[model samples]
Structures are given as C-alpha cells and as structure tokens.
Target: MTYEPELPANSSPADAASSTHKPLHHKPVAKAIHPLNQAANAKWVPINKSFITLTRIILKSALERFGLVNLAITLRCVTQQGYRHLILVNDDRDIQIAAVGRVEEFIISTEMPMTPPAERLSAAEAVTFPVDFQGQRLGYLVALVRNPRVDPGDEIQDHPSASDIKYRLNRVAEEMVGVIKRYQTRYRAIYVYGDQCYWIGNSAALRQLDQRIDTLASSALPILIRGNKGAGKIIAARALHCERHTEIVPFIESGCHEWEEDAATSILQALFAYAKGGTLFLRSVDKLSGENLRVLQAFCTQRTLEKTTKGHAESVDIIFSLSRRDAELPASLQRWLSINTVDLYLPDLRERQEDIRDLTRFFIRECALGKEFDLTESAWQQLEAFPWTDNVEGLKRLIVQLSARAEHPLVDRPLLEGLMVSLD
Candidate 1:
C-alpha cells in the first residue's frame, strides 16, 4: 500500500504551552561540524540508533530554545515519505502524545482511507515508527501537515504532504544546472602539436600512452600516431593541439585525398598562414603522394627567413596519422615520412569484454532519463550475451530501439526476447 507522513494539520491543544522555536547557531551546546565535511549541509542530521543520551541532550536543548514546556511533541514514520520517522519534539523537546496521534493519522489515511473515523483512528494507533531521523525539528514541519489533527514526521514527506520540501528540491536542482556542465578542448604537445583528447578507461596501455603524451608535449620533436581505422587518431591529434604550455593555436585538419595539385598548393598556403605558431594535422598521411610528401618534409624542416604569404614557417608544428594497414606500405615510402611513430592499438569491443556491462549500464541510464522504463536483469543479460559486430555504435542503436519500444516500468525478458526474435 502507498504510505504517507503522520502529523497534525494544525497546532494541537498542547501547542498553547509553547512559544517561539528559532534554531540558535551559538550556545554552550552548539558544536561545530567538521571542516571540509559537505555532509553537514544535508538536511537530515546523522545520529546512531543506540545514541539515546545524545538524542535526548540535543532534543532538550532545542525545546529550551523554543520556549516549550507543556506542549506534547510527536515523531512517526513517514514510510513513502522517507525511510525513517519525522522526529517531532515539543517546544519543550519531548516526544509524547503527538507521536501517537500522528502515527494513528498516517495509518488511517493509508490502510483504511474509506473507513469510519472512529475505526480508522483505532487501526492507526497500533502502527508506530521504529526509528526517527528528523530529531526535534519534526514539529517545525507544520507546513507539510494537511488535516487539522494530522501530525507529520518530516517536512520533506511525499507530494502534497511536503509541498515546502518539493520547493527546496526544485531550488537545488535549478542551482546545479551549469555546475556539472561538460566541455571539450583540443591541444597538441610540443612534440606532436594537436588537441582533441578526452578518453575514459583505466587500461595499462592507455596509462603508458598518457605518460608518453606528457613527455612528448614537452618537446619540439615531430610525432606520428599510427592506429587502425576508426581508432581515434583524430582524437589523439586534437589532444596534442590542446597542450597547456602552448599558445591557443589553430588546428588545421586536411586529408591527403582531398588535395589535387592546385588545391593542395592553395590549401597548404592557407594552412601555413593559419597554422603559424599552431598545429596542422594530416589526417591520413598515407594518402599523400611521393612528391607531396617531399614537399611537406621540406615545409616542416625549413627555417623562416621572413614571413611569406603563408606567414612564418619556423613556428608551426605538424602531426600525422596513418592506419596500421597503411603502415605496412613500401619501405621506400616509409623513409619519406618516417619520424617518431606511436602505435595506438585500439582494442575491439569483444577484446574489452569487461567494459561492456558498465558501458551498457551507462548507455541505458543516459537513454532512459524521463522515461518510465528500466531494463530488467534478464533483458540486460540477453543484450550482454549478444556478439556486437559494430562495437559501440551498434550497441547504442540497439539500446535506442529497445527504449523506444518499452511500455512497462522495466524492459523484461519477454520484451527482449521479442526484440531479439525480430532482429534475427
């Protein structure tokens, strides 16, 4: 059954005995939260289940400050509202008749919504809160109570009951909008000269490559990254351009196949002008002809005598990418563009099996936001068992399709089986 908070809608007869209830920041009883502890900012105060004496001490202090004497306070479980009770403490900080009254009201509202008031009240009194988290502040949550006789456990109860709490949560969500925003940057090391590098994984190969990149970024040597097709060569090139020590430079990306004789000349001239004190990434270095390679070599090796139409030559850095398939080219060609080659052996999705589960979970969470569906364990298992030929791209499409078809709260085995059958 759905649950709710137990609390009074209006001040009870006992409330007439209390005065103000302002929380004080400084007193002999006031203690400081640990420095750098973000948890202290949380609304719910932390207390151990066995710390009865500490609980009493804090409660007594709050009551004295609130000028409470004869008022009866109550604490009761919020259930659907929370995992624990809203600890209602009187102005005098005593948890007494109010707790019983609130718990009874909650039971009446949830279990016997249509029952007569006398029968519901009797049925409610039998239910009680086993634990309390709100401490003495439960009484202050008056804004959450609706019925004139109802007493709530905490102010942040379920919807309608905790309107104030919903407002607070909304405020928090709004303030956090741009705080976690992500951005992209591309840079080249002094050695490679390019940028566009954001990768996630804790593999040993990647760590070693990161170290190499750091060292290379500190030097002026030419660097080459050799990888397989779609192996993130462009990503590496962009990362090289975004080095911290270098000036914000233009990153020129040009493929060898995109150049004819005149086009290549014009592009090179334009690049030289734009790439002064920056980086130029030759996306597929393997596509350059022998004559063009020689010309590129001359351009890189030369010192600037004066600025030409293409600007100063000595300040620009060059990075090249070649696929491993192209790396096995004629020995004569290797000599033409040979420099410090860094092999990037990108693992196939099958080879990185350990990442599949985590990656799938991430993709599901990303795709399911604002959706009513969640994938069942069996459905996820089916996805995990399938052999993906297109790697991450294929997995993304499959997830999108599955999410589009989901109607229930979870994409169960039946849904997945049907999807798999259709695909096959």
Candidate 2:
C-alpha cells in the first residue's frame, strides 16, 4: 500500500510520527548530479524568474494541467541538489506520487504500506503543508529530503539548513494551491448543450437540475423527459448517458414520426439491435403509431421479464422525450413508465427568468471567443423581460445575431433594440 501524509484530527505529534514505518529524513546519497538540476544551476536563473515562467505555463494549459506533475517539476528545479520526493493528496483521499528524485528505491522502501491519516502530520525528517483555497482544505503537500548524511537530530551542522528547505517547499506549495483553485472554478462554469458548448447558469433552478441529472445518471431505470420544444430534453439525455458510462456505449436515436408507416417493426428491430447494452433515445415518443406503440410495449415487457430471472442479460435502456403539448401517453406505456422509469420535467426559459442574464453572458462569451464585452443595464433588462417562446434555443440564436451585428465591444440598449427589430 502507498503511504499518505494525512493524520486524524485528534492525532498528537507522537501518533503522527509512529504512523510511518521509518522517518522521512533519511535518504541515499547521490552518486552523480542529475542533468536537469545541473543545467538549471549553470544558467543561474533567479528562483522568482523560474516561478513566473512556470505560472505562465500553468495558466496556458489550465484545462489539461495535472497539479501533481506541475508542482513536482517546479519544486525540483528551484531547490538545492538533493534527493526530493513530492507527494500530493486530493480531497477524495487519493494519493499521487508526483515526483521522485534519484533515490526512488529508498523513499518507496521507507514509506510503503501505510495509510494517510485524516489530519496533517509533520516530522523532523519531512515537512507537510496543508493546501487550502478560500479557507477550505483541498489537500496536503509533503516534501521529503533524500540526503542520508544530513542528521535530523543535529540540524546546526547541516550545510543547507532544514529551515531553508522548509521555506522553499512552502512557497512552491502556495503556488500549486492557487492553480488548483482556478482550475476548479473554470470547470464549474463550463457546460455543453448539444453541439454548442457554453458556460452554465448559477441559478437555484439550474443547480437543482444538475443535482437531479447526477442522481439519474447512475441508475438503470428508464427515463421519461417532459419539456417544451427547445427546452433541452435531448441535451439532458445525452449528458446523463455520458456521465453514467465511460466506455463507448452506442447511443441510438430515432424520431417516432419516422415509424408512422408500416415498416415500424424493422426500424425498431434495427434500433434495438444497435442499442443492445447501451441506450435508445426516442424523440417525441407520443407521436408513435399504434403498431409502434405495441412493439415498444412488448419490447419493454420482454426486457423486464428477462431482467427478473437472467440478471446478467444484456439490456437496452430506453429514454423517451415528449413535448408537454403532446397528448397523454397510452395506458400501456404509462404503466411501463410508472413501474420502472423516472419522470423529469424541465422548466421553460420563461419559468426560470432569473437565469436569463447568466445564460446571455455564457452565449456572449462563446461568440466573443475570449474577447471581453460589456452589456448595458437596459440591454440586460430587455433580454430578461422578453418572453422566450423557444426557451434556451431561441436565446442562443439571438445572442449569435447580436455578436455578428455589434460594431463595438459595448452592447448597449439601442444596438440590442435595433438587432431585435431586424430579427423580428
């Protein structure tokens, strides 16, 4: 087992020291200098200059950056030539060995088969820094010195004092914490809607919707989505499937209008065959013909029966999207839904008017492609007051038109009004 640096909230210094099999201060001496460290020393680059360069790289690769690797590399380049091991622990209690200097075997042999405690632990051999953002603890960063000749008991005789090492490690840990917080903030704002990707709204309704989607994603039950046209039913379904399964599970989609003819059986058979061990999304399921309805009913019944006895049989999960304007579902379909499916009702844009500003900002950002723009108060009011018949879909189209026609970075009331008149 890999050893972590965390300790219990109530753990004393004695308990923390005993958790690790051996003290962290002891490390095997280096036979030869590492090439990277040697090159770094030759240039004699200032620590602040190297830190600034590393920060720029982290910002540019924000989305793809791994915190552990970035922190490890930065610490190794800035510190003195000694064996250094960097360990990072995440909020989920997952431990990552970010970097191991020349003496990897010595570090592994000393720290393996130990579990991290819940609280922070420190020893004379190593230092542990708690990484926090806005007062919330994110993780712990531990750095161990690898020089075996350095005496833990007699620190005054050591050439590079332990105080110097601690100070450098702490500074590097602070920079790493900032990068992690920024990455998390960006991830929460980003969202995808069908082919168009935009930032998500922060309204209460949107938060609830996200929570509901998360709960439904992990279950095997059928899903019945009811919403107005262009209210994002299909997007929700796709998001649910993507979150639940990691592998490339085939997602087969078909419109019920396509099955209005007599060839419904063949189309459904092909769809079912394609969707085995995956998901089948039926668009406007209420428009299905009587024959198609019977076919679906029988299919659901057979699958239900098979699931009862043969637990390991491959089954297709059905997701039905229906417009609120459509007629009530047939009694048979209703029974199947009631017995083995969850119903999700999406609110139209008009119902959640508070989200208009955030949704507009997201669309504007997508259009600008990182260019900054400002919307006037009156322009924002105009957007929030409008009755969005097409829900989020209509709002997106309007933003695209505004982006195309606006001559300046400032989107004022008059410019917005002029565009609205032209679109009308």
Candidate 3:
C-alpha cells in the first residue's frame, strides 16, 4: 500500500556512501545520509516541529509578529497528487506532519487562512500566500491574525506590519524549500556499510555496543556474539570487519547446525580459506554436536594459514553469533569460545525500545518508496505499545505489513486492528 507523494523519485546522495566504519553522530548531522535516509525522506513525514528545524524556527519567528496568532503551511507532495500540512502556533505544542485534509480541517475550525486568497479582502483578518517554487505551486501559506486595537480597519493593508509579514513569509517559504532539501539529504545520523553491515538507533544500549564493536574490531581475538534471538549480531560482525578494513573484504556466514558429522572438518577448512584475511561469521554454534564441536575446536587450535597447502599465515577474523545465553552454550564449546575471546551482546528490540521510532522511520522510508503515506499518531501509539519480542526485525516486518495494507496514504487508529496488527 505505497501512497505516492507529489515529489520526484529521490536519488542517492553522492556523499552518503562511506568506505570506513563511523559512529552515529549525537549532534545535528550534516546533509549527508546514505541511500537509506535518502530513501526514507520520501516517506519521511515530519513527526515533530523539530523535523525541519531551521524552517520551523523561521516560521516560529513569524509567529512572534504581533497580529498573527496561527500560521499553517500546506506543501504539495512533490511525487504525487496530494498535499502535506504543517502548522505553527504561539504555543509549546510540537506538531506532526499532517495530511492535506488534516490541515484544511484545522484551518476551517479556527477560521485560519487558506489558499487562493479570497477576492477583495473585505472584513478579512487573515492573509494567504501560495508557496511557489520555480513556478510550481507547491502549496499555500496561511496566517490568521487577531485584530490589534491599533487598527480598526478589517482590511489587511490597515495593519502596520501587513507588508512585513508578507515579505518575511515569502522569504520563509523560500528558506523552507532549501531547508527541506538539506533535511531530505541528511536527517539521520545512521552509520551504514552496504546493506548487511549498518547500525541505526540512538539508544544508549546501541551506542555502548558500538563502542564495544569499535574496541574489538582492531583485535585479532575470536569473538562470541550472544544475543537473545534478535537481530544485528551478524551486522555487528560486518561492522567490525568494515572497521578493520578499508577495501572490500570477504565476509562469510555459515550456520553451525548445517555441519554434518562426515564433512564438518572439510566445511570448516573451506570457510577459513574462503574468508582468509577477512571475517567469518558462524551462526548458532551452540547447536553443533559435541563431536562436531570438538572437530572445530581442534581445527581452530592447530590450523594457522601457514600450515595449510595454500597457507601463508593469512589471518581470518572469526565471529560466532548465537541466540542463547553464555551459560546455555555447551560447556566444552563455551570454554573454546571464551578462551581469550571477546564476548559481544546484541540487545533485542525489547531492550532497545527507545530506538523504535527511528527504526520505524527508516523502514518506512525504505519500504514506502517516496509515497506520501502515514501512520497517524494514534496509530503510532498502538504500534509503540505492542511488545515486539521478535526484535528490530519484527518491527520492520510490521511496518512492511502496514505498508502492504495501506489503501490510501493514512493509517489511523480505527484501522489499526483490522489493517495491520495481528497477534495470532
């Protein structure tokens, strides 16, 4: 259920792609996001006023004008045939990106300004301006003014700062477009390395994990990444490899459960050779049989690259990812994995709930394909309330589900149960 926006299809920003690993920026980031953020910007509706910080600030400044009490702007979706509503009032309420109709309703309810300035401003206390860019009517800017006692005239011309409001607002609309462009390019501080090895989130847990990843990437020690059946462990390994190398390096992942008794040693040796001078991720090694585990332990202890026929002492970083607690792993394998090894923990979605919003935004932007779609605040409330025990991967799946069911752009509270969420 991808809803089209009134904007052109976004292209990847040239500066978004990075070769090395980077930590997420805690400060305001530059106008550089990888394809991920650029992609999300299409579906990236502003959830709060701080979204387009500079634009909102300038618009708020306009609100500081004496006569004006409310300001609303409707932006024509660039990719599709629709509009987006933005509102700024002289209050502390942070508004979300609303639909075209939503803004119209608010304007009508308050008798605020709307588009196509009514012919002959008689007894009118409001002004409406078309937000135009490059001859395109992007949307409308409406400002509702309370009659100040200074002027008894109902006409806008009677206000001392009428012309000033118009001039400053027009300037604001101009700056709005520029600021939006900047935001669309770089709204997130995500660190990405290809599709498989990028981390997203602002959670302390994630940041701490990142510090650990950074610390371990340089070491030659074997790593045991234990997570509670969630996501990002392998991705963590990929990030580690990325931090360890500037050039493209082989990153191989094989499940330990797939190893058979007859061919376990052969498969192990093959994986090592294939990922020489790179990283090999072994998933769920706790599932390996005791005999196969011993096979691995012996092979890892004895074999250096120099001992083999094709060996030159080539180093391969081995990372083991399992979905169990350290205590749960077989004692023998655990001893082998723990020997002078780094133990990295991947927190599941439940532990990193704080990052859910950003994760949802990222996934929506990726899946929505620049369409003007929405999950309303109420819809979001329900979504946030659901415990996604499956982790970030589960949240992604749910967003994808919602995207699939959207008949139009908006997914509101009433539709949540029937349309997307399914506990069974």
Task: Name the best candidate (by TM-score).
Answer: 2
Top lDDT prediction, candidate number:
3
Expressed as tens digits, the lDDT of each residue in 357-412 for candidate 2 is 86787788887566677788888888888777788878888888887777787889
TM-score of each: 0.43, 0.53, 0.52
lDDT of 3 by residue, 201-240 (tens): 5465765676677678766567888876556776676666
Off by over 4 Å in 2: 1-194, 197-199, 218-220, 309-313, 325-336, 368-372, 421-424
Q: lDDT score, residue 311, model 1?
A: 44
lDDT tens per residue, model 1, 140-242: 1111122223434323334332444334423322211101110122111212232223343333344344445555655545667776553456656655655
> Candidate 2 — which pairs collide?
6-117, 7-117, 7-118, 7-119
Q: For candidate 3, which ten residues in a row score worst on lDDT? A: 1-10
Residue 142 lDDT, candidate 2, scale 0-100? 57
Off by over 4 Å in 3: 1-197, 304-313, 325-327, 418-424
How do all the candidates rank in terms of TM-score, highest first? 2, 3, 1
- Local distance difference test, each candidate: 0.43, 0.53, 0.56
